[model samples]
Target chain A: MSTIFQDLVDTLRKSTLHFADTKKLMNTLNIIVTIKQVPDTAEVRIDPKTNSLMREGVPSIINPEDRNALEAALALREAHDGTVTALSMGPPQARDALEEALCMGADLAVLLSDRAFAGADTLITAFTLSRAIMKIAKYDLILCGRQAIDGDTAQVGPQIAGFLDLPQVTYAEGLELKKGGSLIVQRGLEDSNQWVQVKLPALITVTGRINHPRYPNLYNVADSCDDAKIKIWTAKDLQLPQAMLGLGASPTTVKKIFEPDRKMKGEMIPGDERQMAEALITKLKEMHVI
Target chain B: MIQLVPEKCIGCKLCVKACLFGGIAVDGKVPRLTDSCTGCGACVDVCRVEAIIASGEKTGPVCDFAAYKGIWVFAEQHAGKLHSVTLELLGKARELADARSAEVTAVLLGSGIAALDGELFRHGADRVLLTDAPFLANYRTAPYERIVARLICEHKPEVILIGATTTGRDLAPRLANRLRTGLTADCTGLEIGPEGGLLQTRPAFGGNIMATIATPNHRPQMATVRPGVMQARLFENKKGETVRIAVSEEPGDGLVQILKTLAREKSSVSLEKAEVIVSGGRGMGEPKNFKLLENLAGLLSGEVGASRAAVDLGWMPHDHQVGQTGKTVKPRIYIACGISGAVQHLAGMQSSDIIIAINRDPAAPIFQAATFGMVGDALKIIPELISQLNANT
Candidate 1:
């Protein structure tokens, strides 16, 4: 068992003993949270000629969905005693997001950063994260946001589960503790919902509806900045091959990025109520809309 | 000039299944590309076996015609009811077809949906291609793709348009993959080009920028439009005709089954479809504070919504979230509270009829887009607005 998992188990056992009713308390609870620092999506701009993102001056922050995932983990910690560890892979600045996680209530933070870990697509990203989790050794549950706001691929969680050879319950809305070391979770499917039970050490990706995250207090924020003990590991430190860490490991590459030209000026029809309706109808007819 | 390595082929046959041009064939255990391949790389993404490679070279049959021939719209229907977006697309298609002196054809597919044929023609389809099959009843991936691809192949329409719904998203990619054609998804605007091609425009980079794409080299340029973005043409008195096509007898795996569907109790209003929306943000403070937004929405006969910030804070459900990650809405009136108007949130509701911003921060970005701006606390402004509205009522 990994140290973090053992610590989580210990915390759960202690809580169970304190409660004095194993039947009432949930068993085998541990949370592994996946977080990422993406360029603030609101601040991103595109160069018209290149059609590529103008990333400069855009501040990076924890992805909103990832923050929700962290909050879900924290809520689980509060409801049923367990340890929450934050994990991320990016440049050195990514440590800030993990630190924010610690300040928010994460017991530990892990940074997977190195030059070789750059330019990773979702597949390579999930692979590296799964490998890092394997190295961490102990975790009863894994949690991530459904998708990153920037890419909007919604592929990482499922890909990571595929890499780790684990059954995944994605788009999780709610979680409940079951008696036999299993979790009953409500998953959101398109047009419907499903409830599934999975054993310990399962992976789940949470949507924004899962839980409301609490804001960090002044003391916790101060402690997060001052009492920093973030464990930083490179591909070498994790014993991962260099080829499997970065662009070399990634299967997909963006060949070109260009702005699509807008041929017609999207005109907004204007006038008073009757005139407006008439103009809209006339415009539609003129354009052969009818 | 996409390439497929025989050695790398795991024989998942996604490329074979996706090829609309019929340019690829499964030879025992590998996919073999032919001279008709257009190098669109639609198959590259779906090939889990990673056998298909995009060489990025243009080495297929170049379209010989300088002038486009026909205008097509990928007509979308659900539960025997055609989406208004499809009619809206027909409106746009009618414009393009008139400009190019081409014919407008709407492609309809589903089981026993012939009753909708007359309605489709009345909404501007010069001709309708109907395909009925039991397999296409519930919007399954494989059957819809097969029917749409077959129609496109047979009819050879110059341009094809589909609404960017869940069904359209799934079908377009697969059809594009099969046809070796270019497809642009989530287009907010579209125009017919001088060269008789399509100018497909959509927001990219997390809705930070708008991109207009064109498929100059491929026939039947494809694009998907969002619902409510385009204006649907009013019904006309002119008569039109429908042609029914035989459904193919190809067997589908049907690996995924719908065991049961439980309609979630419609709790709050659906923000995307609501005419009026009142959205709250982190500025509202605690989760309890969101009730003011709910009250305001109720008074306005609107739906309560939240920015990604409020949703992230767990103050509201994800369905009510208005941002890039959530639902895109175009309501008649959208009142934002305490929301700083993050670009993601703006992208979803920027097209609203009237925008009202209530924020303590004078420099909030929402002010730029708002028709009415009040520099005050949302907690204070909300109750006041509610009382004023009550007085009027």
Candidate 2:
């Protein structure tokens, strides 16, 4: 077994470390920031025949929100003592994103690549990530972007938490570590922002407003390109369940994902408030919209 | 498994004629699925060539929730109080369950919420699964996760509804993952479909389309219902049974401890939660001028909002700014005042139910997108409109 996997087995066997003893057991936090290399959504097109994303031609970027997640992890490293690991599950070309993350100061980068993982959706993606995270370390925390731009599902991070039986906070805009191994986070939900305190060994999917990402220095960029230390783990390396690796493992499939017709090409109404309001309300009433 | 290899298919009309469900139709040289084809091999029967293959899908462990029979909702709590969205979910779930001839059950987890089980029933639950633990007083994932996962595994409800609050968002996925079940997030609508499947509908692609998803193969279909979309029906006198279960997972083991919970302070009109909003832009001119919009908003019982340009010019506070850099609002009505809208500003409020733009510049892009538009100055038009509204009301 890999030493990282062995560490997890050892940690599990040793019993839960008390908050007081945790600081002594590991002074530095081990954080794994899960990211994805999604095709630039701005140029997204769907293959009508296949109903799959046409990811060709549109260059891939480290998912925009993942950049904020990486920035959050980096900030956590700056505040506390820890190494941030950038991890992704995608095709072989996903290495480019890992390289970019390394340039942005991720301490270690790992990629889980295999033809078996190609059609994995959020559930399977989370399963694959949890396996890699276990192989990486008995990490104290896992961070992810709120959602990838391509799928925009916001499911993977929390799903990973489920697989690992860990606590999760999604849409986190602010995060901080408390004195006794607790994590304080500002979660931005659909309607409100809430401050929550969660115990360690948690996962947080950060929102884009969390932090301003820093551009990597030229030296670091070239260095990461030349000496990129990305560990590639496949199904065999993780020794995961075969059913959970590919499409066969997926519990749900996209029946269809065509763009909807929500576009409103508004028509200008010539009138003042009395005329416009009455006319508009009348139209809305006619449609039973009001 | 099905593959549509455009190159291999010889544009044979045989498969088109062979499809039983009319799922396939010829679109130019290639065949396109006019409807959702079941991949039932009818087309493969008459392909006359190797182009169509009967690919078998490996059915891995059919852990179907089909055996489950009751509809369940997770009554969400914050700081020991139940949320309104819980009621919303229960109302919707109760309707769906009644349609399927199933009972509505609610799972309540908290320190001292047994007495509150009545509240769940009042909102529509027929039964309550109450797990009260000292550790459950605060919303922590570990304890709640164990109870939810265990309850689902044991009871095997036909459908589970959860309010898509922050707590539900975090807790639902973890529990669903543990159950190895499918969950639809941020769903706006739910109904019982064929074979008692939960038809979960939600907006996708930036609210451009509404997608209805179902978990036919999985049992106990789960959905996280969005708040405010569903009505919260309350009964003066309600009936329900409370079942207590012993939780196996200890509370504190969830390594994370809550030291403090800071709820976001809503001092003034939060643009996000407001039902109606009237926003001003830089064209309103001055900080004092915002009062005119506020007066108009008061007459309409709405909140005053600001465009990024107005906020940037110190006419209004930054907290009120609406755009890409600001909070997105989905109010019932959005009225833009003197605002020549920018794309960034439009992105924020375009999703509102009704958009009314009042700008002197008829050429402004906002006019093109507004549900109603008027070419006039805010200084002259809004006061007259407010006076007219006041006189009418």
Best by lDDT: 2
DockQ of every model listed? 0.10, 0.17
Clashes of each: 6, 3
lDDT of 1 by residue, B1-393 (tens): 677888988776766665556668778787888876656454553455547765534332245544446888877887798988899888888888888888889988888798887787777788888888777776655466667778777677788888766456546644554454556666677787666567876666676656666766566677777666777785677567788888765554242223334656665567767878989999999999888888877876789889988887778977788876667788878888899876667777878876777788866767767755666777876776666556645
Write model 1 residue lDDT over A1-290, tens digit each, in one string.
12243244334434533222122223346678999888877666555456466798777778878988999888877777777879999988787787678667777788999999997755568768877887777778899997677766555676665455454666778877667667777766545566666666677778776877766543343334433346888988766556445765453343334443322223333333334334433443464412
For model 1, which pairs clash?
A: A51-A259, A260-B212, B18-B178, B19-B178, B20-B178, B20-B179
- Which numbered prediction scores highest in DockQ against the true structure? 2
lDDT string, candidate 2, B141-193, tens digits: 76787678767767788888887666787777777676566788777668887
Candidate 2 off by > 4 Å: A1-27, A39-61, A79-82, A149-152, A167-201, A232-242, A258-268, A271-290, B1-66, B246-254, B270-275, B279-295, B305-333, B336-393
Docking quality tier of model 2: incorrect
DockQ of 2: 0.17
Error of 1 at B337 (Å): 1.8
